[model samples]
Target: MKRVWIAVALLLAVLAGTLSHSFYLNSFTQELTGLLEAAEAKAEQNEWASAEELTQLAHHKWDEKTAYLHILLRHSETDEVYTSFREVAEFIQCQEGGEYSAANARLIAELELLAEAEQLNLKNIL
Candidate 1:
């Protein structure tokens, strides 16, 4: 009986960890997507200054979240996103609409892929 109880407790702890990780990943991706979208919108409007400001904000947020993410995510993917963030800022400064939009799209796709991988789904668990 004691052994069975210990097993159950361990199982519960694992489940809790998985769920918490999933929740954290989802929340982070949502916030980031919103930031990227705002930057893209500003670019669409030809508001280069506003777009640059929002892209900088996104970079700041990414830096703040990097420590936690580095533990949970693939280094290459995270690094790719970091690079994209920098490119987006540069494109915004140049007011290159096409390149700026493309960079934002790449960032959003990377964030989505990262979040999905972290989700507590059968595919990920298996």
Candidate 2:
């Protein structure tokens, strides 16, 4: 009876941990989606500085999402989207010799689309 109780306790602990991790991943993915949308909207309005800041924020959120994906799903479609957005964000950050407004705007739009698609995929999974 003591052995059976110990096994049951361990199973419950594992289940709880899995549920908590899923909740965290869902929250992080939603945040990334919002940041990407905001960045794109700011860029569309020609708010270059604000767009740049939001892009950085989105990139950070994507990084967190990617980390969670690595641990939970291990190279899912979201991981590919995260990698693409990370590359785009880095490219935008590196463009120092040109007028960044147009290029940044385009990148933001791309990031927004990618985030939306990823969010949809997450919705199906969840």
Candidate 3:
């Protein structure tokens, strides 16, 4: 009888832990999704400042060690949205006889690296 009780307790504990983890992941994913949407909207409006801000918010809210992989994969499909805004911004600068700064180039490179890393990580997850 004692052994049966111990087994039951262990099972309950495991189940509870699993449930808690699932809930947390779901909540985090929802927040990440919202952030992604905000970024997309900002990009669509050619609001680079807002888009960058949204991306930063997403990064801060993400679980970098784990959630980042999933977010990266998701972001990959939306790259064109972001790239479009960036290109437009650059083109505007160019037309004004202003050079696209090295900083802007570096930022784009960083974004690409993040997307690639996310893609690779998604494969690993699968």
Of the candidates shown, which would achieve the greatest TM-score relative to the real structure?
Answer: 1
**Residue-by-residue lDDT tens digits, candidate 1, 1-126:** 999999999999998998998898898788988988988998899988888887788789889989988887889988998988888888888888998888889888988998998887679779
lDDT tens digits, residues 1-126, model 3?
A: 999999999999986765565455455555655665665565557675775676566555543533444443455534543554455345433432123233333444444444443332346367
lDDT of each: 0.87, 0.60, 0.51
Off by over 4 Å in 2: 64-68, 76-78, 87-126
The candidate, 2 or 3, that scores higher on TM-score is 2
TM-scores of all candidate predictions against the true structure: 0.92, 0.61, 0.52
**TM-score comparison, 1 vs 3, better candidate:** 1
In model 1, where do residues sit more than 4 Å from their true spots?
none
Compared with the true structure, the alpha-carbon lDDT of candidate 3 equals 0.51
